[model samples]
Target: MKKSILNLRLFNSQVHSRNVESKEKWLGYLFGPCGALLLNAIMATYLNVYYTDVLKLTAIWGGAFLVMFPLASKIIDAVTNVVMGYVIDRTRTKQGKARPWLLLSAPLVAISGILLFTVPNADLGVQAIWVTISYNLFYSFAFTIYNMSHNLMCPLSTRNTVQRGGLSVFNQISTIMMSGIVVALIFPMAIMPFLGVDKSKWILVMSFFSIVALPLTLLEYYFTKERVTEENVGKEEKKIPFLVQLKVVLSDKYMIIMLVYFLIYTIGTTLKNIGLVYYCNYVLGTYNDGVTQMLVSVIGGVPMGIGIFAVWPLAKKFGKKNVTVVGFLLYALGSAVCWMAPRSLPIVLAGQFIKNIGGLPCAYVFMALFADGLDHIEWKSGIRCDGMAMSLYNIIAVATVGIATAIFNALLSGAGYVAPELVDGVTVAAEQSKTVNDVITFSFVGLETITGLAMAGLLLFLTVEKTIGKKQQKIREYQKAEALARGEEWEEPEVKAAKEEEAFFVESEEIFRQELKLKCEKKGLNYDEELQKHIDKVSLKRKKEAEKKNKAKEKEELRLRRIEEKQREKSARLTPEQRGKKEEKARIRAERDEKKWQEELLKGEAYRAKIQAALAKRTK
Candidate 1:
């Protein structure tokens, strides 16, 4: 009796420890980006306004600065993204690849963000130079580092679907609260009033937010642990090269679907947010010291608040893809309503509320889908390149900000928007023509509606959710095999149970099929004929899919081989020393390729065995 009581106490203690650990990990995610996200919201929504309206850059350069600079910066920023991804993939430390970057990004991001708002008091040319330099440093470099690391934490957290879904929910909640507090409340109420449209006051406000981000980053670092990353450490040489990683990612049909969806959704959202202030001031004609802007935010935010709680349940019931499709359809409908809405406050607010509610599932739950995409890549390619995957995702996110800003500025320029001028201690905006108001309305409403519809259309092609369970199961089996190869003393209980559960399900399914065949036979039916027809159909479908995959694989391999052959031939014409270096690099690559081939072969054998066993059971 005493032994039983002691065992119960021990079990309770273990469970408590696990619960605490889980809670701590989530807390890290919740608090890590609190300050950073607030800063991002401010920049996304108002930075263009600051450049055009406040800094008078539009007056100086006539939209060239706004349009050309961001486009040019994005071109350079894309290369920087690839380099950062490579660095992250090669990095190894006790703190993990993603977390260390998170820690390092804090100060760099803070300093750059502050400087972006704090342009020097100088001539127009000097200001342009300063703005260009500072924007690249912050958005392209520092924020890239921070965001890529931030995104990687989701995949690194755990492989459990439910847990990942929960993390994504927490992530959305944090984003909503931080963005809501800054954009909805603080910017309109406190900062705008105190500064009253002065560009100089932006320096002080931005500085405050930058400083606040530092401690929050520290809290994130302390609370988060990279369990998935720990398992992947010391396998650097086994990783697919950067080019190969990119190929694998691009090969996945689901990743392509997500990429297109992200581009459309991001561009649409950015345009709407940036155009909101102009829409209120120019179209609605109710610019009461930022009150209209605040109201719009509040109206949109209320539905968003409810949506953060509502989306997960709806997704669980209807499936993530279906829920997303429905959400975007409703969002597009609401945007259409807004486009046709009268300039009435209540009507506009109602449209915005509907739009927010419709967009809730996509706003939060898509991260899990991206995680599922990574799992699919690993299952197909036998490699896990989290750094590369997250980097590409971040690039899409950051690039859209630049693209949206460029497009918005170009539209404003076309619409003949004259920059506001400061006169006699007050800034006065120029009177806009009807065309200008129309452009603002179209940008803020029509563009988003179109993009939302496009996203829904693209999501129809995504089928990852259907295969995620099997992919996860295969990943677990691979991990277990790796552990056994390393001669570990104990297996993880969760992994063991999962394997057992899978076996039981497979066995039960085989038994049920056999029973159905026997019942048909007893009923004097053509059991074998019907069974053969069903099997033949399934076999044909599987065969076609396998052929397509094999073709892609062979094409990629052929491309790689051609490139290598060309390099070798070119090296033969070089100096002895140069040829030696080239040959050495070639040798190293060959060895890595051989190792990868062997690993794939082993995995193929295991898969074939599993399939063969199931087939035999069914036939018997």
Candidate 2:
């Protein structure tokens, strides 16, 4: 039962490393994401401003680059993560299957984090294009490493549902925390100085601020331990060809849903966030990034922090799907309000608060929901697929992000806004102004529709509530106990089947009852006391079924009758003369039913004879 003597020991030989694992795991998740956040703060939020205002790139092209770079990570994320996931599933490593992926990739993530933000001071034309290509490549690669391992760790860290929820929630807190630092601080400090607004050394200033994200990421690797089993890990797995792997991964329904949702939500959100800078500058007539970003942070930040906690509790109570639907509907509503609101800052701020409140619960739910999929699939197939599954999901998620970025970039270009060539002033073509408005309107409406789709997906999740209920916690414990006895890691279908007979019996009872009745219902077969008892059993069951069905029919009839009565009253109002005709038809229908009952009475003898013949054949 100890960690060492088990079939696999990838990450650690120690079973009780709460002390060592605690801090190390915490930091591993932190450093990578925080670093990514700082990088994104520079890429997603500030880069457009820097290109337009400082570097004087054209709005169309600059916006295109800004949107395309981070978005390109989607393509990079899809392929890399799936490969890594399959590799992890098939890998045999002493450091643990996932740790190697993380350890090797962690530094890359940090390096890429820095690269994405570090722009060359070369002239606008060539350098802008080069920077776009380079930043996206680095980000795509870095996030692939970080997001895969980070996600894999959720399943690896603990098997308990409650513990998973707790872990997922806190990690999201890390997401929010890092997001705050990225948008609120990193953007203005790193990109603004070079625009002739401040005299600070932008490069060193950014590196210093951005480098702080690394230690936080490294912490995740240290505190977290990978829990692997022989069943879960396979050094000799049939390495799937890339095309086959891609096909199978895409076929997973849950993965596709999450993928689409991520694409829509991320793109919509990015458009809204990036557009805020433009909205404040031109529409509201202010260039103060600090005030605008601060206001956004307060509106968005506080709700996000609160949402992480709120979602778990509400999901536990009402189900994760219900809460997510409600949350998204709120998001849809907020999107509409903001789109229609006049260019007043107060109205916009109010809209943001509403949107943030609606979005908070959903942001945390999808990550934790993956735990449910891991259990349900294993239970159904007896095949361990968390690695490939996670990879497939991540790839789609990343790709959608790519498309969103691409769309936003295209929107900006079509708007015809040119990036500011001079140090302190930006030139806006009429097309640019028109495009900005269209982008805003599109974002508000488009995101709302996606939210509706998200709600529909959440409904599909409801069926699992009963079968998998309260069993996620027990399943993990059972996994370890059975593996200990069998000298393996995961449970084979035979092993899992032993624990599932209770469920099988419950499902099969009705069929068994019917078979028993068929044998008992024989005539002239020298029936004994045993036959009599069985007949009693079948009769009682028949009575119960009939009673239930009759009750349901009665209720349905009552509802229909009420509806018909209302129709009758409404029709009478339309044509007073038609009322007598309607009453005549009702009387004819009653008389027809009475004649059918008399006919049934006349046929009773024939019906009894048929029953007798059936009994004789059953006896024969």
Candidate 3:
């Protein structure tokens, strides 16, 4: 049994190493998020409705709790994100850093998700406490672990940028399909009418979703390969300090831009999602059944689903930022049209379809954008903070959802929207007025429109796409330099191949020289003189090659110097406070660089000691 287990383990290792090269591996990556996001969509879209309608939480309490609880949890979640990132970065395991977390988190997330919707029969205050505890447990802690790990899988899966883009497309398609299933089918067709908004029924539905999600997570784990992560498996010195990683990632202009764009984008999408139920119920007069919600979801989801395929190719052609900007503009226009349209179902559906069409680029391509930003961070800082980058990405996404929920709740409460009471397992909804309907409309259309436009404006500053090739080259150079500095045997493929070819030529040349020497001796000629001539020729050729290399190095250094000089000149033009900020940023970067240098130095010493010990052992 022991031998069999060992053999199985070795077989798994062999399969994992080859997974990245397998074209079919994308099936695993594509389906991994399906089950997870199905549950996620339900929670993000319907939890508020459940709280207000089924649990009978007052609008004021619901709004305040949703806002304040998540806001308070943000501090903890932020710390958790960063710490989890560092933990993943430092983790050394056969399963890889990010994948192990996915396995651990799958069951935890499932259990916590069920608990989040499964509050006991209690008084209002008691239920509020339960909701807070359960929500913080699941979303702030358990889900963060899962989400951060899941997102970091992209960069770790493969280093090929084109493959990364393909993965992003698959991810978006999965997410859209999941959203459609939850919003268009499950919530409306199964849960709403059949389950009748009962708390117990909601719990059952959540439990069912959670159970289905578990196996998918395992499948995802089985299918994905952490190729990039495998390369850094045993390199402890490669792990940067959390503070330094945070500083370097945050200091990146493109990172900040992507974060802001995502924040605004999340706020807009969250508000629209939260408001959709209310809009259908109050504004469209479909409170009795979830037909309008289903209709809107199906209408929006179809175009968005179809549109995702176009996004990858368009992103490749026009760049992710440009495509996203265009998408946002179209989305804003669609929202404006929705705001103006009458309460006709077809018109509303039409607007929704258009809006979803416009949202495709941002929805489908932002992960790729974030991945690009991570590369930029790695290129600029000489470190890959996939953990830190994805952690902050998760935080921004979660925080924006909270903020959007808070705003939605506040608006609902201010508009005099009332929570329904559960009597004998039936929810008695309040009679909503025009003010409530108007608030829902504005929240769904007006708010989304404004935020979408703001996202477009902010995204115009993004210029990362143009210089990605150069940045990637710099990252390769940095990696090679770091490897050499630590006395490790690492080289770029081209460089290693070139060196091997040169060595082969030198060996052949020496063989030829020996043959020539024998001939010279046989002919009673000056053998030493012929050898000297051959040595001079080879030496002169090496001199020319060395000079060429030196010239290339000098040119690169001059280019970098000019860029830095221009930056310094730009800094000189800044105001006093801005200049102070710039100086502080420079100090942090210097500190990070110094720490990196010390790590390399220590690694070099350790490597030398290792070599010396090995030599001593061999001699003995």
Error of 2 at 432 (Å): 6.0
lDDT of 3 at 80: 82
Better of 1 and 2 by TM-score: 1
Q: Each candidate's lDDT (Cα)?
A: 0.76, 0.58, 0.75
TM-score of each: 0.76, 0.66, 0.75
Q: Which segments of candidate 3 are over 4 A away from where they belong? A: 1-26, 59-67, 421-428, 491-620
Alpha-carbon deviation at 528 in model 3, angstroms: 62
Q: After superposition, how far is residue 435 of candidate 3 from its true place, in Å?
A: 1.9
Error of 1 at 303 (Å): 1.6
Model 1, span 413-433: residue lDDT tens: 978988766688676777788
- Model 1 worst lDDT window (10 residues): 11-20
Question: After superposing candidate 1, which stretches have Cα over 4 Å from the reference?
Answer: 1-26, 233-237, 485-490, 493-620
Decide which is better by lDDT, 2 or 3.
Answer: 3
**Residue 332 error for model 3, in Å?**
0.6
